[model samples]
Every structure is written in structure tokens, then in C-alpha cells.
Target: MTNTFSPLATYDRDAVRHWTYGTASTQVPIPPPTGSPYLSDLSFVSGANGWGPVERDSSNGEQAAGDGQPITIRGTAYTKGLGVHAAADVAFYLGGNCTRLTATVGIDDEVAPYGSVTFALVADGRTLTTTPVLTGDSTAVPLDVDVSGVQDLHLVVQDGGDGNAHDHADWADARLTCAQ
Candidate 1:
């Protein structure tokens, strides 16, 4: 006599699993900025928040979503940007309407002397630009990438081989130059 078990019997259909990498888990529709091409104003196709929800035009804080302070990096305050934590990904669908993307990337000062992370810009599944390992002591790095004819854009932040502790990251003054 032999006994066999079906894989379907062990599967939990109602269980919800959370993903921290690869694809995003949240999606939101953003209103366009008036007379400006800031990425913060564009709708995000998908997003994954590492710790707290990504903050718009503010620094990643320990508080609830949208409850962050002004985006600050190296003591410099920015009026426009996206505040996210490490192991985060924010994707936007450009539909080939954008030409260039620019931003000042850095580890938010809120976690100074604590967190470390790396920032990357991926266009249509290809890495257009990436930054070196950035720490709280590092100054903000400027990024300028050409996204000509690209349909998808992903702004990613990864923990620098270290645990995601206080890994607050910021994309300051992020903007996209696109056709009107």
C-alpha cells in the first residue's frame, strides 16, 4: 500500500503574502503639477514601501503616511521630492512621453549616522543610472538620465548590503522633462 498527498491540499488560497522586492505592492494616481514636470506630480504605476509609506515632497519619517517632514539631505531642505525607505521601488508609466529625468538623491538626514542605501534609475527594464553606496554622512548625489522613448521608469532604493534600519532615502527635486 502507498499513500500520496496532493500539493493543492496544502495551499492556502485565502492567505495574503507580502513582497518586499521585485514588483511593487501599491499603486496610486497622482495629479499633474501645474506648469511643472515634477515626477512627484506624475501617477505611480506601482510602489513598495519598505518601512512607512512613501511620502510626497517630504522626508521619510517614522510617523504614518503623509506625515513626514520636509525633504532634507545633508541639512539641505528640499521643497519637492519623494521620501522612501530602502528596499523600496516606485514605478511610473511614461508611455514614451518623457525625455529626461533628474534628481538629487541621498540618504535622508532624519536617519543620519544610521542608514545606508543605494539609488538606481531603471528605464524599460534597463538600468540607466545608479549611485554608489550612500550613507548618512554622504552628500546628496545628482542624477541626470535620458529616458528617450522609454515607456516605464522605476526609481529604486536598496539597502547597502546591510539591514534596513533607518534606511530613509530621498529623491529631492525630482523632475522629468516631457512633451506637453
Candidate 2:
């Protein structure tokens, strides 16, 4: 006796040929950055709790500070101007997988360059050659870094300037990519 059973089709013929991408487990593991040691190097070089302390404008203003990571001495972390002066920096040692960095801010894009909102990735409080590259304007804003050959990266925030500075900047959703 022969038995015949139908198997589920993972794909349909000619529906659309696409690369098989492994579904990243929705059970995303939360990267470390908690209390006690407010400055932990679990992700990068040195993580911080707060990155800015600016003044209050008639408009609720805010900006990011800096990032933390190892200046591997082989890469140049670059930052592009976003919305006039908004900038973002990343850690190079974080590796290629550690490219995406997201910062949240609210400030008038027309303000006279009172100060800079620099949310950067650093290693022991300094910008190294291995820092990530930042780009974009205020409209579609974000700083994407390439941390492919790096590790032990951290994030920080700092007002590029002071006095008549703005306030309010919350950074989160920092995703690190790994090099294959």
C-alpha cells in the first residue's frame, strides 16, 4: 500500500522570485544600558544617561549630545549637516551591523546657530578615526553608521555649544549590524 500526503507550499510558482531572508526572531533581545552603571560599555565604549542640558526657547527645543565607542584608529566617523546644523555620529568599531542610530529631537530649524545637537559615538570620550558616518537634512533626518569590523560600541549626546541652547532630545532604537 502506498500513501500520498500533501505538503504545504512555502512559495508559489512565478508569484515573485525573491531572496530567502531569514526572519529575525521577533523575540528581539534588548541591548544592555540600564541603571547602577549609568555609563556602561556593554554596547559600545561608554553609554550615558543624559547628553544635554540646554535652555528653553519660546518653542520647546531639544538636541542630542554624543556617542561612545572605541576609536579603532582606522576609520573616520563622519557627520553631515541635517536641517541646517543638526548632526549625527556613530562608532566605527561597533562593526558593519552596527550602522543604524536614531535620535529624537524637536527644535526650530531656523534658529540662529546657537549650538550644535551632536549625538555621536565615542570611545573613552573622544572622536576617533573609526567613528561612523552621519548624513541627511532636518526633513528626513538620521545618522547611519557602518560598524562592520568593530565591537564594544557606545552612544552619547552633547550640545555642540551652550548658552541660548535648546532642550529635549531622546535617543533610542539603536540597531547594530554584524558583518558576515
- lDDT agreement with native, every candidate: 0.84, 0.32
List candidate 1 stretches off by more than 4 Å: 1-36
* Model 2: per-residue Cα lDDT over 60-158, one tens digit each: 233443322221111222121111122323222332234333332323333422233445555434443221222222321344554333344544444
lDDT of 2: 0.32
Predicted structure with the largest TM-score when compared to the true one: 1
Model 2: ten consecutive residues of lowest lDDT = 71-80
Residue 50 accuracy (lDDT) in model 2: 33
TM-score of each: 0.80, 0.33
Off by over 4 Å in 2: 1-46, 50-116, 123-140, 163-166
Question: Cα RMSD (Å) per model?
Answer: 11.1, 17.0
**What is the Cα-based TM-score of model 1?**
0.80
lDDT of 1 by residue, 30-146 (tens): 433223477777767788889888888998897598878899998899999999998999998777777888899998888897899999999889998889999999999999889
Q: Model 2, residue 86: what's the lDDT?
A: 29
